[model samples]
Target chain A: MERDDIIEYSLDTHHDEEAGKKIRKKIYFVTVLLSVVTAIEVAMGIIWGKAHIDVDGMGWLTIKSIFIILTLLKAGYIVMVFMHLGDERKSLRNVILIPYVLFIGYLFFILLVESSFIFYVKDVIGWV
Target chain B: MAGEATKAIDQAELWGGGRSPFSVSYGKMMMWFFLISDALTFGGFLSALAFARHHLEDAWPVTENIFFHFPLTHAHLPLLYVALMTFILIISSVTMVLAVEAGHRMDRKGVVKWMAFTVLGGAIFVGSQAWEWMTFIAGPDGLLSTSADNASLTSNPYGPQLYADFFFFITGFHGTHVLSGVVINLIVLIRSMQGWYDERGHYEMVEKVGLYWHFIDLVWVFVFTFFYLI
Candidate 1:
């Protein structure tokens, strides 16, 4: 008898070795991509440290932005490829990712802006 | 009878019942929902860290100075150890994916092998974190303890007190997740060996656990970036 669970959810995954090889290739590609991005991030951190520049300067800010961007790139690969969300149906993907993008984006904005304001307040109060 | 029941239902109803709207199993759907909530929790912690880092201004310690030690070496490496930990977690993620792939093919032996590696990687990562905490709280000069009478939370020689607090809290939280992931992996690995999925005639359990495993790795990426890298 055909298992209804498998049929209903369409568990008809890549079953053969030929299809497995293609999936393996994609896995290797994503692994390398994540590693390279991580290496580049570390390299940037080292180079920035060696520069002996002002931590609060515009240059530091630019580098921080780069770090955030690269981190997001790494996150994208992990979520899409490693998590296999990329292969999942679009409805599932939307249900999972939409809230995160919107909520986290708003949270970061509000918190960071308020953080700077707090810093200013602490500065006035001679508080570290 | 159920096949007839399914056929009797309107196919285009979408949510008219007798159908999965997301085209995934119910367990998988619930897993995704759980992961969404978990992501927000981690998001709150990391963003709060960011908030405090900025709130303290120049009082925040440069992470390099705080975390420069490497194992078995006196040389100052600066974030190198954390970098290694990141690679370990990523490699485990790869192994978890491989295991999931093997499950899809119903290659029982392949699933067991890859799951073993995944569990090992997670154990190593958590152990490394413990070692890191040891070194972190016991600094080069003296105790890095923020709780000692000599240095309380309000004042500490190692930059701001919030620095150590957040370091412990955020990374500690991530470490707990990794630890649990390892346990879950071990259970799944043993079950895979005992032919549990084989008896069930499907390996959706492996895929579900794989999703959770990948989410753990995903969280680590964010933690490494926010906690160590930047």
Candidate 2:
């Protein structure tokens, strides 16, 4: 019969003081990294606000690309560290991430190609 | 007997059937799967926004102008308040990871303390969102008959009606997630306090709740980039 006090696994079995310290250190490091990236994003927004949107050019696209890259970097760190996805097996990581990369890339590809279907392409029919 | 022995060998060579192939708890695996589906759902929302933005091009509302209001002051401080919210969410994510780590050590009090901080951070973020929505509704007035900064599902003074619609839908959906996350964290915090998981011999529930919470924060990073920054 199982007793009320029986803990199947010992309370101290998984506890490693060194591991705990490392985890805490990693948490603080990731937190600061995310904050710094966000601050950079905000600074870019302030610098480009009202000025860039009103004037349409390649510069706006460049700034946007920067934002997207930074955002993805932040997402990667969060998933790997905060959610412990990094600790999972290689097969598990691939199974989870591959679909997202393939599908989301396809979505954005159509976003560039198909979404502008109405616009004039010089190859198709120029001079509206 | 030979056929049965061969079939058992095939099973052993492939999946093994006894241990998890993923090397994670069944519940954690389920949470990961659920988050995958949810991420796709959010991808749809953001992609829809992208479609509209591309179609409208320059006519699209500049995010900085539309969301520039800061509370209790007349200053037009674009992206500052939203940035504050982002930092709060990130810091809370740190506290959540700390709580899960504490659970690993079976330090119940540590779990409780950090979980309380996480809960408070989530509540403040949700409250900040509410203020933002209210400010969005009571938008700017005057300057043009097309009006200044007001927004509604049908009307928008800034750019197009589509702007208001997408804003409401994307941020609204994410805010709903945050609200639900807050509620879930509160429930988990109470259970941790009550020694519910200690009796079960594991604090796996905290870990599960933590995965959900971090997922919420993860989605917010995307929303902030796609909606506001880009």
Candidate 3:
């Protein structure tokens, strides 16, 4: 089959070796980034999860917050890079990602707030 | 009169929409749409878990304490296995994207190799999840059920009984996804070897499947954080 018959995405570029090498390098780079983030998260959970070290006035940099933030960061990178959203047009990226972010925020708000409200009611009213 | 009216409608513009609307193929667009919905489903489940734990409050099982057992060793090791599983999934996701990249280059050999690794990674992860489920169900020291009526809120020793229920349900649901991903990946790997994508002139199938695989990996990241780390 003729080479021209095959369609080229960024990786091919009419059989350019450098283009293929560059794409391969990008894949490994992402792998390293994700591994580092996972290691950080696991370390945080292991080291400070139970320590509860308090800051003077700023409140404790709780392990929970660290886990959430790190997880979100990892998730964002995985979505952007692995799913190829980062290479997509800005408008396409926004169209796919923004609404999910909004929905997740809304879901978290409701569940967290309502749970606290329920906890208060149950404790105060002596209800099961 | 009818021919003139039809010509006025600009038939070329009406029938042909030029390039794809989002400049992505139909398959990729649909995959994104499906993943968005799937993400919400997972988000809902995780939020429900948070709600249950919050309601249980002080009675909720300390996640670290509950998931502390490492395989073969009796010593309490918090998040060790779960963290390993997360790494495996992340590595598999990397391989999957590599496969897609190889496909973009029309490198048949590279696609097969990377995708096979991805399938292997996925199989291992699913097996590990099964092991986790078995270990969890068996409980530490073989205490499967403290009593027959274990569901009762009053007599439960392990905080709220809902903790175990949620743990099983959420992880089981996610495990099923991983299982299906493995199957789908295996199919894609085989097809690549058969020159399926090469015949089609593009490796978009690999890209589509890669999207799903990465989404599963992404979900596991959240699950690992909320389910075990927290």
Clashing pairs in 2: none
Instruction: Say which candidate scores most in DockQ.
Output: 1
**Docking quality (DockQ) for each candidate:** 0.48, 0.36, 0.37
Global lDDT of each candidate: 0.82, 0.81, 0.77
What tens-digit string does per-residue lDDT give for candidate 1 at B1-230? 44433323335433446666556666778888999999999999998988988777576777787788899998988888898999999999999999998988899999999999999999999999999878776655645555553333354557778877777788888899999999999999999999999887678888899989898988888888887767
TM-score of each model, in listed order: 0.89, 0.87, 0.85
Best by lDDT: 1
What share of the reference contacts survives in each candidate? Answer: 0.60, 0.60, 0.57
RMSD of each: 4.7, 7.0, 6.6
Second chain TM-score, each model:
0.88, 0.88, 0.86
Predicted candidate 2 versus true structure: per-residue lDDT over B1-230, tens digit per residue = 12122112222223334444454556777788999999999999899888877757657777787788887887989999999999999999989999999998878999999999999999999999988877786666523333445567887766778888988898889889889988999999999999998886678788888999999999999999988887
> Candidate 3 on B98-153: residue-level lDDT in tens?
88878877889999999999999999999998877666665545455655433232
Model 1 stretches astray by more than 4 angstroms: A1-10, A124-128, B1-16, B142-156
What's the distance in Å from true for residue A43, model 2?
Answer: 0.8
TM-score of 1: 0.89
Model 1 chain B: weakest 10-residue lDDT segment is B5-14
Model 3 chain A: weakest 10-residue lDDT segment is A4-13
